[model samples]
Target: MSPSIEKNNNNNSSIARESITEQVTINEKLNLCFPLESLTQVRSDLINYSKINDKKLDQGLLSQLMIDDNLLCRYMKRRRGHIEPSVQFIIGALEWRHSLGLDKCSEETFPVELFSSGGLFILGHDNTGNTVLHIRVSHFYKIPELIGLVKQFVMFHMYKADEMGSRSFPLTGGWVLVFDCSNASLAQGDPEMLAFINSSLKNYFPAGQKYILIINLNWVLRAIKTLAFTWYPSAVKNRIKFISIKQVTDYIPLNELPDYLGGSVNCYRSIPKNCTTLETLRSNGSITLAQSAYDKIIKILTLVN
Candidate 1:
């Protein structure tokens, strides 16, 4: 109860308060870097939810989930409340794929020859610097294969988005999908294909598809659009444009597209044999760079916890 003892107790109380204040300040900074609703925690909750539903998570899948979270967080940081619903929808699609025991489609397993020969290729960037994914819908017969090819292209766009640091807003500096349905037939409209396309546009493409220009839209495409619109959210539906073959130049310059699509460029070539494998894509420098950043963010989260 002496003056010295009382002073010592007061000093200890002051130090404790300072420590708590410092901790709160650190957390506020972290929340700026990483929102309070951490994507890592969301991923964990998803994994646990999957397990309860009799789905097992393997290391490879877990690694992918991490990458996905990283990609989502990168964009979500900028958009935050505006895009969280879309981000969550994407996570749900991933979870559904995992639950169905569907392995992530690899570049090797993808029908590269079919895509190359059939006229689906990256036709360089559009006028606005968005990567153009040129697809010849006529060449596709098998719906699942088409879905797989599209999925690979989606990943390709994500890779480019990461490289460009297109994190400020969803679909900013992303992909412009040009679907040339010149020879597309009504017979190609399988329910499963429609479902997959709907899912991709709604759940996956929202983050990367800056503009979806369906050119050479015949009756078949018009019919498909009717069906797809029923499932597409309003934001996604707004990005889609049913255009004439000649109208594509409004979005993509003639020099950027392939020769067949009114451009002088010869863009169709075999997928590099070495780069055809999923391993190669996974080891891409851009992806590695993004993953490094992701790892650091995760480390911070770990320390905070």
Candidate 2:
């Protein structure tokens, strides 16, 4: 063939080889070799769908969408590889996090009572390496008026759990939630908060919940919960298990659990006491206050085996 024709054929061959190599690399890395939709196609579809929907993500979110293969895989798997729904779900999560200033939330943003009460805290990890989120439901009623703060507080833990778990189990990182319902009453079940949590599990944090343990739930609450289970997807509903304190050890090693749950972990020590808001610490050039919060998190996370 002529010189120009040969050059064109060589360029085409190079392009074809690069394409096949990229596909193999993605499959090996993600371990997701979907027959119909590849990761590349899903990512391209996400960008195009975002534009079509008039959803303009900020640079950080855009980067996550494009570069975080694990994140994209989670959303894609959640939606069963449906490109449009996956894009919409992730965009919604990103926008919601940005709107709530989720990253900015810390122990200092709310009263010490919230953290001190031990209503919600990251205890340790499960037997399978998932982060454990402990919630003493009764304590939630103490600060009824602080529901807004509580919402942010809960999301902060979730975001932090995802961040922490991703480090250890990058592809399949998730959290195990334990709701201690011993002294909790129906009145403490704020409709708004419950709805927020339900929606969060279904939409915001896609495929990020490995298990949900409900300890000490009375029959009445169990019946009520059975009715509520109808609203959840089977994938989510199936992960929830009702168990007593003793059975908790089946999922989480006894040593990783807190004393209240018949384990050796002393979670109370990790609670940051009298720490100033991170914002205030940043403004005043006070590293000690910030370090306290950082240390608290480090201590809490390290407690998990």
Candidate 3:
């Protein structure tokens, strides 16, 4: 049977969700849509596997895994609906998170300069309601020594994005990563840090990346992309698009973007002075640091109007 690809009108990304009889495949937008039979069977297999391998599983991982259909589907899809390998992938991800203490990671885990640098933050939401993560590649060059810290910081955002996904209306639970490479040169690409980042995005964030927009293309950025593309897996590579800064308005509105990116909002002054720890934020259900900063900018804009 021919696949019936349906556009999800509610999303700004115009992601197409395809349904075919007995089988479905990844869409043009690289959306993770499979037939219900494969999804259901993989889910059941995981649950059954968990029962038999309880001793091998993390204490609460099974319960958490069972409840999140999206998470299960993501891993299953990543492994192409193979039950055993999918379970292994999920288990490996859980182990990596535990080893890294990702759940306990917080603002204090790294230097204050990391957050205040304005290199990485949550700017606003795109048209699809997915959170927009702005990463200033130029800023990263200034602190090459802090590569490990930088890795943790990026992962922390991924953790929060997942948290946000669980609570948000759309349930998309991932980030629209906007890597602003303006003024950044090829010299800024630290191989160690780049390798770490590449591994994390591929292994850790299961179906978590909504889109990766590389804006302000220059020769330097072009060189970096040439190298980086080789490092990305087919799944990760598919979601990336090289767009000019002006074209960013297609996925994200002009009003939500900062002036640097051809948006009206000036979020420079809106960076949060302090942030709640990841654990505290998780427990209290508070807004994210990035969201808080964007909110501050919006509030000021509203007041002036």
Candidate 4:
């Protein structure tokens, strides 16, 4: 289907559940509608081929990252003395995504986070049984300053590798990068970051490029806030998309996600439906999966135009 039709249909499909749409949940909706049969098959196949000790894909990747990436090895080793708690988890997640393509218990990145419902949900209960963390570390500092922090954090060890040993590290070549903003937003869209990001969106993100943007999600709020009423809106329309990482639990049927983008018509209908999604789905879990798929598939039954 054409992008416009897909967007329109996707937007109109979720009329019943717009009352509380969060980022990851919106992501789930998009994924659910995209191609589940294929995605599930790929997911299962990946797990079967991988999964050491029955560990999740992300976990396995972390292990591989330590052994295979030299720059990363030095980075980790350097931090041996530092031993920061936040870095431990962040490094673990980044390593996993860098090496293996897997989602988390709550929802991790392809290469970023874990699987699940609301990250900050009450006890964080995802249908898939993953606990997600909804954190937004902000540094209302300059973009260059933040970027420098990231580079220093990652490349610091990269530079130290020479003193540590060139042959003993796996990170001689840094890991590839892939950046997706589908689940991102900024507080105040900073023009500097926005411009750079949009430019990358246009000419940089080649078919298989892997990018790493090490920033707290909350930074997105700040980054986005700056761009909300900026001059780039028209120039960068649809070039990039961001989803908030907060709405994981508010899930219903994928078929019901599109209506969310309907602006007002669907918005009006969404209020009441969202209020009752829990009860509705709770009573009908038996059929929601199939029904959601069918509703979306039926839309393209003819595949005309």
Candidate 5:
């Protein structure tokens, strides 16, 4: 009708269009989508791990900004070794100054969620052989189920061998964390999912204690892990240090991996103090920020006493 009225109508129309765009997942433009809570947990754990190693990386103010991005799910060719991409995610998670609003951002989609939350990450691999990844959210309950559901989707779709998780590799005598790869899709649970996992474990793996969910971060963008330091007991806390993979790989005289994870391994507080790679892996469960100490724990798997 009038000039002001026409402008108002145009503004409303624009808002409506933007809302629809958010819902649509076009082929080339999908923001990093991950279950909110899971991502937070993993990120928090890694930050703790980093502190123990104490190497130090570039940190920014908006490092903890809550935003849904597909940064981790998709694979970038340039990423090599564990440390490089891990560091990249930390830096990229900082405040995006240019404000491209995700979909338009030129950077490859990154799933910072894989750090802690489980979700489907679309990693477009080259026309080579298949890659495998298996993720297990051990304390899948008490938090939320959406994290598991999303991860199931990403693993199934992208990696042929990737799965929700089943029996943590081969633990001695313990209830296995069951994984149903057959049902390779998101299955929402009311309250029953958590109940079922506990119930089933009690029946099948009653002896299983301290579940070591053997997850594969095969093509993961940022591997976030959350550990409860409170559960670590003081005896385990003081001996944290970085050891080399070469150090422990050869020390095995056990019948079968000494329970799949060695007990002699140590967890360090910082990466800077790493004398070898083994120590780096053991203590790197959390490493985004080198903070004092939070609710995270590094359960280093060692061979012998």
Candidate 6:
């Protein structure tokens, strides 16, 4: 063979070796994080489901789902012996989300006042190092807005959690919620809203939550809790705790919490009028993923369903 022909053959061989090495590395990582048999079973189930639904699994989508770090973390950290079901659910949910084009939904469509007025704030971490999500329940009048706000907050932390995992700290892997109801009224404590909130905390958030601290708890909230827990899952009920403002430091460090919540820190700075969209949060480093990343995650998830 001529010299150029030999050189071309060498390049092709090198590329083939690299591809095989990459595949092996991925498989090894997957095996380390999940039982290979369980992973294979879940994939087989997905393939069967697609056939029954008259849908074909795109190789590119499957590849993306397999290599996604967030999905890997979610599966690996699922409750012991539940990894298979978690994989199935994550894949199926992604497929459905993709089919509905829910990935295209933008934060601009949400009410700007949700963030501008401090309805939801990612107020750093708690004493236990769990990410603190502060929700001003009084600001929300409608259930839909409340739901949207919580989803957005969760999405923001999901990305942050992924970044933290890369750094080996995983700060957003666990959460400690502070439901500041200091100014909340009885009317705002709607049963439907409470149910929705409970469902989101239980079903949506990856890695689950550590604690849900309801500040300024009163007789009205006490009454609402009775109705809310009737429908709330028992596992999450153990994590929920009501505390007076003075008792905040007992659960969270004073330096990490907000001044309004009886902590020394004042993290809730005013949102500038121009910073009305989710992009503003991204720019401030308060949010990790861009709109495209969010859409990509939804598309990946929707492929299996």
RMSD of each: 14.0, 8.8, 12.8, 26.0, 20.6, 14.1
- Stretches off by above 4 angstroms in model 3 are 1-63, 142-145, 166-174, 233-235, 268-305
Q: Count clashing residue pairs in model 5.
A: 53
The lDDT per prediction is 0.57, 0.69, 0.64, 0.31, 0.29, 0.58
TM-score-wise, the better of 1 and 5 is 1
Q: Candidate 2 has what TM-score?
A: 0.73
Q: TM-score of predicted model 4?
A: 0.21
Best of the candidates, lDDT: 2
Candidate 1: count of backbone clashes, pairs at least 3 residues apart or interchain: 0
Give a tens-digit lDDT track for model 2, residues 68-161.
7776676677777676677667777777876776645666665454566677888778888888888877666523333455688888887778
Which runs in model 5 stand beyond 4 Å of their true positions?
Answer: 1-7, 15-23, 27-31, 34-305
User: Highest TM-score, which number?
Assistant: 2
Clashes of each: 0, 0, 0, 57, 53, 5
Error of 2 at 228 (Å): 1.9
lDDT of 4 by residue, 1-305 (tens): 99999988878767535633554475465433223233334334434445442443345444543333333333333333232422353344444433322222111111011011111111121232222121112212233312432222222222222223333222232222212233344523345644544443233111211122222245546545455437455534443233442342232122222222221222211111112222243255512335554443334222210
Model 5's lDDT to the true fold?
0.29
Alpha-carbon shift of residue 247 in model 5 (angstroms)? 32
Candidate 2 local Cα displacement, residue 150, angstroms = 0.6
Q: Give the poorly placed runs of model 1, Cα more than 4 Å off.
A: 1-70, 74-91, 99-104, 142-173, 189-191, 204-206, 274-305
Per-candidate TM-scores read 0.60, 0.73, 0.66, 0.21, 0.19, 0.62
The candidate with the higher lDDT, 3 or 4, is: 3
Between candidates 2 and 5, the one scoring higher on TM-score is: 2
Per-residue error at 54 for model 4, in Å? 10
Error of 3 at 76 (Å): 2.8
Any runs in candidate 4 off by more than 4 Å, and if so which? 1-57, 69-71, 74-87, 90-288, 297-305
lDDT of 5 at 107: 13
